[model samples]
Target chain A: MARRPLQEINAGSMADIAFLLLIFFLVTTTMDQDIGILRQLPPPVPEDLETPPVKKRNVYEVLVNSRNQLLVEGERMDIADLKEGAKMFYTNPNKDPDLPILTRQTRGAVEENITLLQQALVKDPKNKQLETDLKKWKGKLSAIELIGEYDELPTSALISLQNDRGTKYAMYISVQNELSAAINELRNELAQDKFGVAYSELNPSVAEDKPKIKAIRAVYPQRISEAEPKDISGN
Target chain B: MSKFTRKGKKGTPAVSTASLPDIIFMLLFFFMVVTVMRQDDPKVSISKPNATETEKLEKKSLVDYINVGTPIDTRFGTEPKIQLDDAFAEVVDIQFWIKENRDRRDEAEKPLITTSLKVDSDVKMGVVTDIKQELREAQALKINYSVNKGSALDNN
Candidate 1:
């Protein structure tokens, strides 16, 4: 007897199988993004170190109580008004004596200061502290020259954020967002004036835009200091 | 006889579907490449707070998540709990978790790892503070407070 002829299996159902898998994956996939406010925490302080003294005028104190009430610079303030208040404190455009002091240093002065620090380093070549100071002074000089605006730089001004343990997380984040927005707003203005672009528009990953970003940041540095929470919880 | 004689009656020619499976497979592969499978199903329910100044986390692999919210499991109680990886964890378990996470990464990428805190808005600051303190001790200084993009003024 002759051998039975071979029969080909149907492949018409393959599309249906693939369709089932595609639907399964489409339903199961989550396109949620990962985004947030980036922050760097201060390192643990050493036990034997002495606390540095900060002047009352130099610190913009922001306190949030257990009830989520905001006390900004010893005055009760609504959360909505925080950004404007922070911008005022940082910029001090009017040079108000009550606000943080802004030291107007010219390019000549910074260059001279850098020379003096360098001369001091020459005497004690191994002085790491002096070397760092020189480097910082040089950076300031570049920043001052890069930004053609006024030489007014916040000498010692910083925002001190303090909160009660019972404060709601949403309130805390709101405060943080305001503070960040304040700095970013200032940077945007400065970047717009100097570089003809917003601060956020400058790509930090690019080599040409690095100095522009650094200059803007140097002009309005984010000096928010998050202090340890006090025992103000109602519970 | 004409070269073009009338053809005999015949049924309509069927449209070829030989390429249908290939097209489906192409779509399947597209979804497979673009899809990021959920790594850990969060046991805690999280509703992130809103913020205006949020930055997109660039590298997902370099970020380790610490979820803080009310647990979905009622047996654990309604109080805000910390979820590390697959299970609920205490504040103290953070250090060990950080170490384990660090050990699994490449040496060069270890320092770049960021700890993203996915905390519910309604949770108290105390729990968040405790986690931050533990993170500082663990020397995982870089952190991202995960939040949705919205106006801070709207929060008030």
Candidate 2:
């Protein structure tokens, strides 16, 4: 005898269940991706070490008062002009006497220094300082290899960012953003000029782009020194 | 005699919804994949300042957020308060929070964790400076200042 036709299971409730779940997720979960300005804080300073004096020309001073006014390089300026001023200070294109000095380093000079450091390391064998110096010179040699033989490096330029205690967080971030933008713009231009690619396009995580990114970063290192906030507001 | 006769009493056929469950399931899966679960309900209401040079924070799991702003409850007063996880905290609590969070992570992932500071725009820098000092003391140096993506001019 033939069996009776089997009945189909109802799936009408399945859609309702899925809709409920979807609504729950939509309400509970945040869709906005977290984006931000990345920064690395300097380690706490030791009491014994004295602060090194930076040359006046090498320091690009950016002061933000509590009143949200910007004092850039001893000149009162608007927020919009800060990026250009920073770029000018960083590049020092005209070899201005007031701007940061750009020292040219030849490949031969870097290699010679590396060899000397290596010889010194061999003799001491346990000198951590010599080892670190050797590693640094080797890094410089590789960076020089990537970009041409001789390059003018901003060896001592540092952007000093000082803010008042009463300074608004918004103004502080805006200043920081401009400083980062200045560095990024310089890197972007250099990357485009050297590798025919934007700096943002080269990811350090990728093997091939690692050296390119390194070379770019080595040429234009981010050297923003944030001073401890004081009552710079002059209240 | 006709081999087949036409049926005349039939009404218009109802639309088939056999694939409705499948469509809803697809949407449900999409939401599930993209959804980032809310980890902490911020006690301090933060309206992040705007910045031009913003970057996407990769690996959300590796980021611990520290919210700073005016406390939502007026009973705490108007001063900007720091929020560590779900509850309001002081500047001094950052070190302990960092240690606790770092200890929870795997050994290899400890150094890779980032601290994202979600500070309000109207807040003063004094509180932020205190937090930074606290972070530096704790040796949690890698930080990201959470900001809205906008042009620098917009900030002015």
Candidate 3:
């Protein structure tokens, strides 16, 4: 009365099982790569506060309408040419001799003026005379200095973007991307010229060259100021 | 002739399957490594606009997505809706969502959180602007507009 030995289960079918699972995953899996234009939103303005006026020459105004038309600096522009136009406007390499030079001294004077105005306002919050003077000095300090003698620094070049409320989100984002590209393009060019390195490689993670990269960024900072959306009819 | 026929007649000796599991295992690992389990199944239809100047989102963990488009489900109707995580949300819900996401991160990593807006290209700018304002109110200043590469969209 001998009992038959138990038969070993086949391992051969394991491959088939694995293949089935693999195929299932292959069918369901998606390898989507996320990519996009990065931007920082400006701080919310207080209801009672006023946005200081930007001198016409210093502002690189870009407008997008509901139809996705681009109006750059009051001229109808094609979306394809936006990057080059923005770059030229911001760099202004061919200085206009009539424009005032934005030197270290001028910046210092502007800062001093602002501080004095702030102190005066604090002392006499309700004084009409001080308030008027404060507003004037504030405008001067915040003015975009367009110097003909030197290349316009990024700090003084302001990009003002406005869009119609009905503008497509795509167009609005595209414009922003182009403007950012202009700034980044300038920074990369400067980085390559000065440090012989690509701008992306000049990041702070590259500890040895961080300072040099920081200097280059300072020369070509991104200064996009998004204005409130205007009514489509106005555009 | 008969001896030569016997050698050829062995009939391929039952093709060895011993290594079949190993080969399958290798394939399994390959798929596992390449697969990115989607965190959220988009309920809304999204066709991102093409753009020339896009950078690959470097840190995946630091990004939280907000999808804006008309819902795919008929139940939700045709009006454009914002999808945050798993559910439909209003623009105002963005503030709390951002705060919750930020709080979940380590203190040092919280500042690096970026709100990735995956808005359908056809959606009006007004909706996106509202979301941006909400994000600003929540102090989530870093934002990324998700876009496909121009060439990729063209190929499609």
Give a tens-digit lDDT track for model 1, residues A1-235: 9988998888999999999999988976778898899999988777698977878888999999989999999999999899999999987878877788777768888888998998898899999999889888877887887885355655567899999888999999999999999999999998888888999999989999998888777788889989865565456
Indicate the worst ten consecutive residues by lDDT in candidate 3 chain A: A143-152
Query: lDDT tens string, model 2, A1-235?
Result: 9998999998899999999998988878788888999999999888698877778998999999889999988999999999999888877889899997787778889988988888887889999998888887777788888887544555667999999888889999999999999999999999899899999999888999998898888788888989865778676
| Fnat of model 2, as a fraction | 0.88
lDDT of 2 at B127: 89
TM-scores for chain B, in order? 0.89, 0.92, 0.88
Q: Specify the poorest-scoring 10-residue window by lDDT in model 2 chain A.
A: A148-157
Instruction: Estimate the overall C-alpha local distance difference test score of candidate 2.
Output: 0.88
Best by TM-score: 2
Sort every candidate by lDDT, greatest first.
1, 2, 3
lDDT of model number 3: 0.78
Model 1 chain A: lowest-lDDT 10 consecutive positions: A148-157
Q: What is the lDDT of residue A94 in candidate 1?
A: 88
Error of 3 at A233 (Å): 3.2
Ranking under TM-score, best-scoring first? 2, 1, 3
Name the top DockQ candidate.
Answer: 2
Judged by DockQ cut-offs, is candidate 1 incorrect, acceptable, medium or high?
medium
